[model samples]
Target: MKNDSGAVAAVKARANIAEIVGRYVTLRPVGSRLVGPCPFHQETKGSFNVHPDKGFFHCFGCQASGDVIDFFCRINGLEFREGLERLAAEVGVDLGRARSDPRAAAKKRERDACLAMHELADRYFRHLLGRDEGRVAREYLERRGVSAEMIERFSLGVSPEGWQGLQTVLRGRGFDDDSAIIAGLLTQGKNGRTWDRFRGRLMFPIRDGGGRVIAFGGRVMGEGDPKYLNSAETPIYTKGQHLYGLYEARPVMAKTRRALLSEGYLDVITLHQFGYGEACGVLGTAMTHEQAKRLSGFAPRVDLVFDGDAPGRKAALRAAQMLLTLGGACRVVPLPDGEDVDSLLHAQGRDGFEACLERAEDGLNFCLRMVRESYAPREIVAWAGEFLGGLADEGLRALFIPRVASGLGLAEAELRRLLSRPAKRPAPGPRPGETAAPRQPAWELAPRDAQILSFVVRRPDYAAHLAGAGAGELLGNADARLFFARLAGLVSDEAEARLTEPETAFWAKAQMEPPVSDEDAAAFFEELCVFLHEARESDRRRSVMDAIRLAQQRGDSEEALRLLGELQALSGRGDE
Candidate 1:
């Protein structure tokens, strides 16, 4: 099931344990070994000890002892087989697993075909830039500060305007139109015709984490409706799932454990050109749970550098929320109004850019700032609940609770009570010349609901034990439901398989609170289950009350009486 041979052994032999571990942790030489903060588990004091000479490392605090292979597995959340493949790729070793597994052979063939098409398209587009037709695109890039070296290093390309320009080349090279379309290089028209997907545009190849081109984002050279266009979702490419310059940003992100996220292709290029190699861009979309989770894998934190426009600020807030939810660290660097990273870097250079980073605020504080500006004093309690309820650490939550209460002008006990319940949404406002509708209170998950789910995510062993006892069946939160469904798939004895992006994001959010140890698991698990049951019953009671009110409003006495009986039974009260 794994690559046991020439590649894996060579990767291990060539890999320096200290260098590899240093990518995620800052290691200082301590006697014969290097010690740094452990990333696999949460800790303040650095107890993770690494023996570079022996090619093995051990975390004294958490007892996470591992060799290079095991270290990669834990740090990257990969199984042994996947980690081997990634390490092999890193060290430039051929995996040669296709010969052993038919499934692997089939997957390899499909991916290779797609890669070949991308390579050909990249070359064709670059060659097009050399033609007279690309003069406009070239001028545009040069104006945007893209140098000749950058164009080559980034494999920048230009798509010609003709309908069948790229189609002609692919067909001549024995590649079918179907293959081109599947690879996201060609588009078919409504009249049973196919042509180039990108035309008269500057093309930016979107590479995957492994540095292979999977898709393209095309920006129009002149006036156009879309301004920028991206390739459609294909088997190999999902825009929100990959960052623009991650392939180039990998080494730098690894070394710094930080990434600078921007909004456009040129922003990333310009930043990298000016010695900011840790910069990358979101692929033609808002920051997603998947994107946040993916970037967090390489770096501990991502500093968002977006334009200071209303839309840009809104996007930053969304990104901050997603990162906060995922339990990943993030900082927001507010740029001047009407200034983007590309323009700012070109005008001010690295010094100016570093200045902005200096003023950056933590994700939580940035989000809280936004809430304070928009929400009323009374509305702040529910908003704070939504914000602070995601923090997994009780001690940290304890510290923030009073601060938040003081800021909102509420008592700590009152704020804590508000957080223990589901947050309420504001009612819709009245339309012009119309009376306002009465707002109905909506039901949401209680803080206890989040606590139980977080506990399960942090302790998969607990999840497995709870599932055996039918604990998952009692969960009502949509997010919690999705998590338990995925957890069921990874309940095997040796289950170290990675969860999907959304699941991973939820897991990260759950990570805010530390996990209960095996010694305390029984007591803690019982308490959480009791709290969940109580929450569910509370929701059920609310539903019954809503039903009674609706029935009575409709003048249906029979129905109202039946609901009242059910409610009384639930409340353990006899009808008089």
Candidate 2:
């Protein structure tokens, strides 16, 4: 639909929650509910509980509970509208492809128009990449060992020498400054002049899992200074948390049960073209735990492919430490010195690369071997002693205890003594066992709301019992009201009941069918309800006091005054 009122609503109408959830995890029946391992947070035991009667899922372990749509949003990482279309398709609901509200409808049309302009900008850049105008850009990539297929696979494009090339194209398509600004295509200079964020560089459009053009990362073609430019973190693109080639590499990563994590866009593209389709790359920063977890989510084993140079090795080693702690096989694939993954893969070809991959060492073993090879015999013992202190459990320590002796060529007694070095805390740190208070259900309004919801849904009569209870009196947020109302109206057989779950934003958006942060919405609703309840009690006391004052002014007898005082106290204003 070009535009419409409650655009979210139309999508929700057709989205099927059950069908979508079914695609991922197997659902099994247990009492009136279906229980399965939660996807948002990983756990072997079934913490993810689905209640068919309530049409929502709750993870007791992580405090993650949400309706069906929210589950899809969190699991697939889709925007509100996209999630709706997916779920709607699953349920066979018809969304008439257009919005009815004129303002919203117009804005929708304008958004598409801006997106079309961006597409045209990409096309123009792509056209330049193949021509003499883009010779420098083409040469730069060629030097980096990126092939033709790699270029096309990543939709590599180029910005021309001129400043207004993209602006002109976008303007011609009827897009305004607001449009380009929103898409992260344009930035305003100090002098109020607007210019392209990415200029005269190779452009890589970073897509989400669904393949929507979310943002771009650009690499400089000629020697100008600042080499790589990425779309400043926008609403859609989050660099530290996502990999560049993930959209393309996910299926392969899943099938291969491994993710080849590198450090550049071209690195992944080159690897993919060479049939290492599982290869993905983090952006221009240290790989984050979020990125590592995302990689682990798709595949438990990730081969950290870095340039085999000192800098690359350091990065790979750091990644190993972080990822190993996160629980996965973090293998370090060290390419030849001075050669990045792209160059090595190119020179050796796919077969050679696959052979190198076979030699990939486990993170712990790689670290230990590298440490022993670089340090003296005494230094090795000292280092091992210090590092072993990092091991938390005996099982974890046992994993490396035996390996340490063999790697260092030491006796079992010597190695055990080395690994069992006296544990000491840094000046300002907790001794072991000093973890934060376990997360109990420190929840406030949400629990009240959940209870109220269960009751209200069970007895629609209770909604009337909670009439003057401001939006807060009911649930944790304003959206809870919307969620309840939506559930109240659904034709059980036709509607996606999975949406109404408390932890999901999908149902929150579906019921409200608009842009609203359920986080803020829930908090506001809770706070507001608390305020209203306090105010109501205060008002009751004030009314009693006012009556007592009137009785005193009337020169009522002592008994009358005493009676009035007691009544005022009973109203919670004062004691008799």
Candidate 3:
């Protein structure tokens, strides 16, 4: 059934917040609100409070507060839509087979048609895997250490080279050729020809949280340039949004509150087969923001298991950025230079894999180390500042300040001064009957940055005033920088554009403030420009100091003195 606001309200109304929370945590009666140890973060005392009457939860330990739907989404690693569907199923409320709206209903019909095609195609692929031509695919899997039980559990299939293998099966099931193509099972070739998309390959069905097969990933059994192929974006499937083995892994992750992230489909299957049931992998695409958010919902933490090689380390860094950007907890499991999860498990067994995980570095520390390795010594602080600025928690950032400075070979006091500037506070919640609240940033934007963006968003031409003002450099907060950039992009076609979730709420808050008169705008803009100039000058002084330190390290007294002179002049305090 397609969901609507009414169906959501009905499901939430019927569902007991306490009962749902009780499933994951041990709660005790604490007056009106129930208290428990927060599942999202570690706590020695019960700081997680749930208000059943208000239908909301707030964790004092982590400051995490949300409604029932948020709880489901965070705990199960499901998207908003998937979470609603799950809660609806739990509460026994039907959202209707199609939404009440006609346009949505039409889209739902198309999605349903695609879903039916995938279901039929799954059977066809599985049936074909049992045939003579499928022997090679089966043998290849067997050699790769996949068991018959796992093969059945994962619903492994084979797509033969014969162009019409899948096409024939879909047509037999009364599914039209158009439906098959739309479902991503069949491809339209040059000259209006139709053929199977995955041919002579081992097929792995990618399922949603409900175990509904939505897409397929195929790996060639024989020689091919692209070793692995996945379904294109379809009416029902977005590759980056669905992970291989997620459906199987979610249950275990929910219980354990941890998940192992691997590089490929087989790595997830192998890990799960070897007693690591909480393992999942991204589809063929690079890790995405949606994937990171969804994974964070399934488990509070994810251990990224990549090949211990240059490319693997690089991939881990990219992944860490995404997770950290969203304030998701993660660890980077460093393998031997040539090893991956599957190969390591195959060679060293479960004990070896466990040892590797034990040595996993916290995602932040790993990211910091990566930055130190990649950037020049003089530029380390700037990069570190940028990375640390992405952190959502002010307390967490404070704790890391010393380490970041140490990593950059700077004093703690100097680093603290450099990073201690505060950002704007969160806007108040929406009033009754207002639109849904926007997603809040992990860290607030600086007030000046917020004001500048507010004005620029409403008056697009104002962005021109930021040129040569060091506006970008002065923005120490990542969220502010992102909002500023988004605001700039919105200048053209302002009517059709929609602000990002966080930006939407942020803009709403901005609109609530008294309007900026033309006189205030000019003065405010000039003040911001002055602040930007001073901020950029301070940054330059720090760069000079860094250069001086580097010069001294290399025993270059002359160069060190010259850089020190530059720093003194920039600071407007001549060397004493």
Candidate 4:
């Protein structure tokens, strides 16, 4: 969906294309026009070109080009309001009353409600944890060797053991149990009562890259069927959509170009304590293709580490499949039989942990080995073999096939047979109108438009030229002449003799490239007559001085000195 009308309207308001592109991209003068790479698509070539005289964009690589607002929206992934905000920032124009978008606005309001609920709950939990009654949860974590700094870094909180403790607090804050249930912070009981969803536990808040608290994960100190509890999904938070600790890990991963994916929140923290702060984990689900793609945007590679158990093996295999599908590098670390990522780090420290990483298998290879170990029958193994083979690209298959054969101790010919098999369905074709024509200047120029060209190229001198020449004959174009006269009149008489300011204070809304019409030409001529009068006055003063100087040199003292004093006053060179 494109806002074609908005683009057309903004384009019409602009006199030149450079002004349009300047909203999104910086432009530098090249020959007669400004040039910069198009922001419409990801291309480095200055194929997206603009002509200052014509307000439009032409992209050579992918023809999806438009005007200023379109450029802002497409580049920044913003809506009309957001684009207006950016334009306001650029030229300091305040966007007026916003038009109706009730549906989007409602969704934003709901998300804001969810956000506020999360904040209130987080603060309450933190307050509970810091109190004397939270001693049990605090000591339990301390006994487990979790440092105070680590607890604070994770925003660890405690939930009271009483069923109605948190529910009472929320209810007093004007939210009934139903409201808390809707916010995913509480669960209603079958006996017409409500209680805290998390009780007698330490809480860990899960957030996105923007650090907005989307959900919470709580761990119980005592034995239970499910040792950990989490907030249910709400409008702004989705469990499968967000990975735990990703918010904190993102910046580090972006800087390092590597991320470590672990099994639990504690594993993530332990790795950080052991000096791998770019470590993160999935919350109660197998890693999905969506999570893999998001992680890849920050880090070039992800170490898909899981527990050394059957369930962990399955999770690692799923992570590998997603990574292979998305085409990024993955390394798999197999911990000791009884150890998870957390224990391994705590027991071995950074040196021992890194040693394990160094020996880790490539994720795809680890998945292949796991598949070999879990063979159901020859039928199932063959299908697994085929699926694994299909994951490789042509180039990767060439490099990986020999390695896979050697790792499995199978013949290369046999592996080749599985790889050669093709799928029934094919990928989609290129998007329609995806190819952009090579960009050319959108506006045309004359070979003899040097005077118009000089206005932009030589602003100081040429502006002064316009100032000296008065109006109509000063600049070539009627529009330029009219604007220059108005701009020149802005300069005071004191500024005239020194060529300092063209006095264009009144030229604020004055379109430099005004519309050339009969009226404009007439106005130019009117300004020209007044400018010529001043030019003649200047000429007469110079002539009188020359005659006086010649006469003085020949002993005509009266005429020489009289002419010199008159010249100073007429030129505004003397103090008035």
Candidate 5:
């Protein structure tokens, strides 16, 4: 881990933050900093600021701030390690010694190999789609109105009817049977013979947030038992962790801050073809919390474009509940019965699709309507209780409670009481190998504390003076105290690496703030010292008053009188 940290610091030191950020945001010089519209959210004004000298970016509008690694991770939907590796590669840094542990190094190599195999498999599938053997699959796609451009964009491919087609390709490419099987490109039979996992089907390559091919989903082109077959859980890809078409849709979604979430692969492709570039699909599984969170990172609002049948409606309801609980805005776009995004777009084109979107209903309202229509009164209450219980935010829960109550024909008070009852716990505790979530540090600071910290951050020379005045004791927030303690001795640039997750945004924003003048900083420091002294005295006075009341209540008159005398002496000193 020490070596890893060293590697991370080396990468950060070498990588140009502005150059990386400029890829996503068109930045213009603003004094010493660069300014651009925030890629994290939709904004007209250039509130996102990049400090090339400091190697960090901050958005005043959304308060999104971090270093280059943070920017890449957030924008690409990657984890810290993945982002570090990717950036390290880009910056031409060697991480070989950083991953010195043989076991960890081996694991990394295995994941890399799996990813490489998937890429090869993707290329093979695409090649086959252009070959003469792919005539059937190509015809099916043509009839479905899938254009050549879309086919290329999505890397659409086909597996021939024979089992050894992909197997032969992988073997020739030097991928062994075990590795190919692990990558989900080949399956072994009971007779101990390995064959292609996706035969006679249209293949959709699944990629990670960084656009690395990791897995595939294959839909049968002709009559078959299972219409769709997806890659099993692989080292590089999980079932529900990644969404289809997200890599293609990310840029548009970032600009729009909205996404059209549908069910099937064709639905997503069709949506993208029809100019809804901010469209993605779930990977053949029910919407998970991880997927919802990933989508919310790029787009605050998601429009559910699932099929208009009963099962699709049910899926939409579940997805809407999850998104609402996560504090994401969403709408349910209703297509005609038996119509999906693909069928609707093809039959009536963009105008029809736009009309359906125009009729989209709020996610919560959709949930309520569905509950009211499908569930009986008792069931509706249970459903509402379950839904409300899942909401961790009390304010958000309160806002939705009234609507749920009204829709269910129950009094708000009754609904509240029902929710108040002890409900079944979803999980008894953290599962094996999973630790309980850490308690978050209080990130908010009181106004005075914020002012004090802000001044100290801008003018680090005054930190010693503020500390000498017992400013740390007067600070209310734990995060503020920790931040001051950690960064008081270091320069602002040095403080960036020391920040905790809770402190990163604040630190970045403080760095981007206008620098304080020497005179202004001195005056503010003195004023802050005096304020802290007065605040400390006030607190002491209040404590003594409380003691005096307790003494009087206990009939300890002498003690009470003595305390009063001390209080009088203090007041006289203040007056002097």
Candidate 6:
């Protein structure tokens, strides 16, 4: 199936590849391509090459090669569809109208409407914050050491006390109750009347990586039952999919390749104000795999700053486990018994916070300490098994298994065997915590097959030459055969969607190699085809010999002679 061709093509056509990539990497023109140090990884030689004419980039250092959309997605931690939508908006392309499918178009329209409603609501909240009604919230922010600059930077606002305050504003702006409610800006009561969802609270606009307001998180200015109120899941926002200040933190994160993962909006803002610009907060929820993955794009190292209380330590431990399992380096910044990032920063300033960071411990070491403290010696094995079982990558699991085994005084093999069994429900009672692991390729191909597949993936134009070459038949690995079969008639771009995750990774990596000339590709293709043909014949001869031996073992003279003659004919044809 084709992608949203009209929308994708329009966005790509309007996008200047060099200009877009230059925002992240400093580039200088080199022949037809622009060259720069790769933003995806550290390199001093400027191996990242961007071809303006082709509208694609390739990093010789990291093997990252993709079009403008791919670059935007990779750099910003966005999915393909989300990246496309953001780019489409940038290019002034109405994706809904560009789509041919009526149903899909309608859905896109609803999504767009929700986003517009959110923007409108954000403005309304900001307007309320500057007015007389916002006096109480403004005073509260000032008391908490929040500056006017930060208020503007984070788009901090106040929702008026009146239930209909925001409802009226939205209605006046031409937003219906249904649309406002769907955008998580308003709520419907039991009496069937709609009202502002966030009232008498300080508003923090939560944005996506593109800096568009997608949702809001509200904090009570004074005493309240539920201290914090966040926007419910809507068309444009999911609770665990975004970090509060990521949009603002991205620039610093890109430079440092590190992030400060905090647990509150004020914490993130405070960190930034204190020169820790590479800081963001979870949206009032536990850290998630999606959020971890998003952070991994900008920062390879994450410093988790949580409260010093028991619950905060527990949270830090959990977050660190997730970061480690996701192949991210993490450190836990420990605070005093009653301190948090915001409180500590306000009390002691940047110097004090830096001291805490200096005292941060490695993630795995913290995990081991927590587990040892929380669990008894008898329970260590069970805990180790559960943690190791949660890890999907056997190699990563193996690396950790030794350390865990050493900590628990158990054999590494014993822990491996425990993980090998089917996962069981956690034993009854309170547990220390849970952790997750990263993923790796599940299968590998023979060297010869891999070389052939890599060539075809990069030079898809030559796939036609393999039409009658029996290359697929000679592939011993099932993954290689399947990839070859599906990729035979597809273009390089189209092949990505059809491939498995591992296959797509292989395909992308192969594209990083130096482009082969047509003559070189032809010669390589010819040599591989000959090898496959010879291998195929050798297999046929081996099978015939096996059959002849089987017949002879059965003491059937006539059958053995017949098989021998067939084998001789097969060998004769191969020799010819």
Report every candidate's CA lDDT. Answer: 0.74, 0.65, 0.74, 0.63, 0.81, 0.78
RMSD of 5: 8.5
lDDT per residue as tens, model 6, 69-123 = 8888777766676678788788788866344446656766788888888788788
Error of 2 at 226 (Å): 2.4
Top TM-score: which candidate number?
Answer: 6
Instruction: Please provide, for model 2 over 348-403, each residue's C-alpha lDDT reduced to its tens digit, 9 standing for 90 to 100.
Output: 88777777778988898887777777788777766566555555446667776777
Which of 2 and 3 is the better model by lDDT?
3
In candidate 5, what are the lDDT values of residues 1-576, reduced to their tens digit? 011155667988899999999876778998989998776654467889998987788888667787888888887766566677889998998966545456756767788889888888888889988899889889999999999999999999988899798888888988899988887888998898899998999999988877889888899987896889988887787776789999999889867878999999999998989899999999767787767767876677899998888889898998898888777789999899878889999999999999998999999999989998899877887788778887877878989998888877889998888777755423223333224556775568888777777776677677777777888887786667867775564223222335666567766767767888888887887787788878877887888889999999999999998888777765666343
For residues 1-576, write the lDDT of model 1, one tens digit per residue: 011245555777887788888876778888987888776544455788887765667776545665576677666544566577678778777866455556655765665677788888988999989889889988998888898878887889999989999989889888899988888889988897999989899999988655678899899988995888998877667546678998888788756777899999999999889988999998757876567766775666789998888788778987887676555678999887778989998999889888898999887777777777877876676667765776656766787788777765668888877667644533223323234434444434456556566777567666666776667667767555645655654322222333433444344444435557876778887876686678678888899999999999999999999999998888888655
Model 1: pairs clashing at backbone N, Cα or C within 3 Å:
392-512, 392-513
TM-score order, best first, reads: 6, 5, 3, 1, 2, 4
Clashing pairs in 4: 16-52, 62-436, 63-436, 490-503, 491-503
Q: Which stretches of candidate 4 lie over 4 Å from their true place?
A: 1-99, 377-576
In every candidate, how many clashes are there? 2, 14, 2, 5, 0, 0
In angstroms, give how far residue 456 of model 5 lies from its true place.
Answer: 12
lDDT of 3 by residue, 99-194 (tens): 445675576578878988888878878987888978998899888999888899899999888999778878888888887888888889777899
lDDT of 4 by residue, 308-386 (tens): 8889988898787667655568889878888988888778787778888988998878867876677655734364455
Q: TM-score for model 5?
A: 0.74
Task: Give the TM-score (vs. native) of candidate 4.
Answer: 0.58
Task: Give Cα distance to truth, residue 380, candidate 3, Å.
Answer: 3.5
Question: How many clashing residue pairs are found in candidate 1?
Answer: 2
lDDT of 5: 0.81
RMSD of 6: 6.9
Sorting all predicted structures by lDDT, with the top scorer first, yields 5, 6, 3, 1, 2, 4
The TM-score measured for candidate 3 stands at 0.66
